[model samples]
Target: MRKVIGIGETVLDIIFKDNQPVGAVPGGSVFNAMISLGRCGVASTMLTDTGRDRIGDQVVSFLSDNGVCADYVQRFAHGQSPVSLAFLDEANNAQYMFYRDCKVDRQDINIPDLHADDIVLIGSYYALDPAVRQQVVALLDQARAAGAIIYYDINFRPSHRTDVMKVTPNLLDNLDYADIVRGSVDDFEVLYRKQDPETIYKAEISFYCKRFICTRGAQPAVVLADGGVVGEYPVDTTDTVSTIGAGDNFNAGFIYGLLRQGITRDHLDRGLTQQQWDGLIADALAFAAESCKSIYNYISVDFGNNKQLPNHI
Candidate 1:
């Protein structure tokens, strides 16, 4: 089996409601997806940095317990692990406040060898950070050269919106390297000032990557692929406990479809048929919907274990 390799930040998220701390969970954009994928028995590994502190210890243990390899994680002795406070509102949407003790970089550990069938998934500010971008780009370049699919998720938040000009080049560069790109309506609006997801896909993203997924919360996601245009599965909006990791798990499920379909890296941009894309997007919708129903950052056991994912999705 070809392994999935992910590189990103790892942080502990303390969730709050009504100004009081409710729960804390270890999470990051790519971290959440990789964990969910590992739980589903995918061969996965994460490359990230964390402080050599108790929180960092727990983060490492969490990865190991979930079947995600922590061998590539770097531990810095000078700082404490990063943390985020996510405040949930009446709609269960999160507004976040983060804290991190920035530390000097250490040489990254050796990346795992990639096979033609492998997939490399990465995104968020970690991939775009100046200090880390070179290493990340090198990994993506190597993966692409080896015929491994590179998936990029633009999970840009409001905090970065003001720095659009500064990060636009990096964002486009990352897009240029990916075989598939996924982003939400807000991500594009903040970066491209385009609120229409389909327009963002066709006008901005499709020029770089042939496959684009544009997600509109509650509304149908749009899939623009080589074969044709396909609208995504419509999810029923139910009560959500917290919306922290829904998108990350959606990425995981879409990746699951790719793996389950036996898609290889070389065939990434050209392989899937319309029907295949539909099925894949459906799986992603189910995963995202399942996540919205819980306080946890990923799909619950009942949904994860159900063989009815396709039908329900």
Candidate 2:
């Protein structure tokens, strides 16, 4: 069976609405996606670290409950589990304030066995953190050598603007390792000061990676591959309770689509037909839309349990 392997950080998110705390959930860039994929009955594994604390225990339990393998999660005696205070604005978008107890020894986890056609998901500051970048690069290299399809998500945030110059090389390296790159318009705007998908793709992305997915919140997501825009697919505009994990679930949905369509490392290099891309994007959009209906950091278990794969695939 094809598996999805995600490498990133894990955090507990305490969400607030109108200055009042509403809900708390386990979350992380890749963790959110892995949880959704696990619930979707996809074989998923997470490579990350957490403190040997109550929060870490909850995180581990959450992953297991969601059906994600927790064997690769590193638990350290030093430091404390990270947490983020997410304040939801009137638009239902999140503004985050993170609290972390990071130690020098970060990302102390073993790389699981990767096989051909496995999808490797990685990104965010975790991939660029100097303390862990070498390990991340080595893992990426091994996965690529093993014929895995690597998906990179440039989940850059405004808070990292100051480090953009310092991390440019690392970002480029990740782009070079990726078979497909996914990012929101806001991520590109923060990284390159450009919001136009075409300009960003041609000037910043094309030289490194051939496939780029640019998502605009609540707007049609643009797909660029082999040099230019292949097509734009409309997003489902549901009543968004919170946009915290919308993009993460979209990534999971896209990976699910790839598995459903029988896309593998071979198909990634050969590229997909227009029809295939459309079906995949539609699947992704549906997941994102469904996630927006709740404040949870991932797709609800019920949604994933009952979710149907795109018929065209």
Per-residue error for 220 in candidate 1, Å, reads 0.8
- Predicted candidate 2, C-alpha RMSD: 2.1
User: Going through the candidates in order, what is the number of backbone clashes in each?
Assistant: 0, 0
Q: Write the residue-wise lDDT of candidate 2 on 209-280 in tens digits.
A: 999999998788999999878998887657899999999988988998998888877777788889889988
Q: What C-alpha lDDT do the candidate models reach, one value each?
A: 0.82, 0.89
On the 0 to 100 scale, the lDDT of residue 225 in model 2 is 98
Which stretches of model 1 miss by more than 4 angstroms?
A: 301-313
lDDT of 1 by residue, 1-313 (tens): 7778998988999989898998888999999888887777778899998888889999999999887999989888787889998999988889988897766555556688887868899988887887787779878888988888898999998887677788788988999999999999888888878978667777898788888888888778888776357666676767778888889988998988888776665566456777778778877877777777767787765555553223211
The global Cα lDDT (0 to 1) of model 2 is: 0.89
Angstrom error of the Cα, residue 218, model 1: value is: 0.8
Error of 2 at 228 (Å): 1.9
